[model samples]
Target: MSLLNDPCATPAELADRCEEAGLDLAAAPTSSDLEAVGAFMAQWRRVVACSEHEPRAATLNALMLEYASAPWLTDHAGTGWHLHFREPDVDVPRQIAALISVGTALHLSGLGMDRLGICAAGECSKAYADISRNGRQRYCSTTCANREAVRRHRATRASATV
Candidate 1:
């Protein structure tokens, strides 16, 4: 959400966010790297836009087919063995695309296809993953939810006064 929603985000910002998410960036990202990932993020948005499960699953499957490699286990850093769905020694953008594609697949399959969506807030098109206990999320954040709630309350009050 942070990366996709920030249209002005730079390569340095992408590097920072990737580190925060525990992604192993082999080197500092370049503008081209960020652009590549941004391109992939656009395709990922198609999955979020689907109102029905079937389309969502199909879009995600296509992304996985394009980005993800066959699953493998590696201890590249000697820390511990971990599963990777991308080719070994891939660059930042390719690595990110592969990870996000496979991760979204695992998430939706484990949860539900409706788990990803665009925020219901009228003014926001931010994408969100519904990982809540009940899987009924409608807004991207509490701020958006509260803003919509306040808008509704004010509209109701004005209509009642009229």
Candidate 2:
């Protein structure tokens, strides 16, 4: 969701994001690749922002249909085999889209559809995928939580004085 949250407008920035995400890219991403990935992020943000599980599932299913290829097992390196849900020899952007779509599907199903959310802080628009054991996470981070808490406290104090 970082791509959707704070988008990389340039190819270099997109490369940095892929690096931060630890993606093994066969080649440097291009502007066209960045555009494709940005579009994919937009669709994913829709899935995350949906409050209902049924709609979220339908959106995810559509994304998987559009982006994901048939699943295949591979051990590209000498490591143990693992399943890849995308076609081989695609560009980095397509690969990342497949990964995100599949990962989101797994996350929502394994956890709960409500586990995906946008931060509740009024000023923050960041999206988060909740993996907490209790699955009661609301804020994207502790900073947002603290900020909201302080806002509530100050509001309570101001009301009491009135």
Q: Which candidate is the best by lDDT?
A: 2
Structural similarity to truth (TM-score) of each candidate:
0.92, 0.93
Q: Global lDDT for candidate 2?
A: 0.89
Q: What TM-score would you give candidate 2 relative to the actual structure?
A: 0.93
- Clashing residue pairs in candidate 1 are none
lDDT digits (tens) for residues 65-132 of candidate 2: 98899899988864678988888878988888898999899898888888899999999999998989
Question: Per-residue CA lDDT of candidate 1, range 3-111, in tens?
Answer: 6776537898898899898888877899999889889888888888888988888888898888889999999988899999988888888888888889888888899
Computed on alpha carbons, the lDDT of every model, listed in order, comes to: 0.88, 0.89
The list of candidate 1 runs beyond 4 A from truth reads: none
The per-residue C-alpha lDDT of model 1 at residue 64 equals 84
Angstrom error at residue 56, model 2:
0.6
Give the clashing pairs for model 2: none
Off by over 4 Å in 2: none
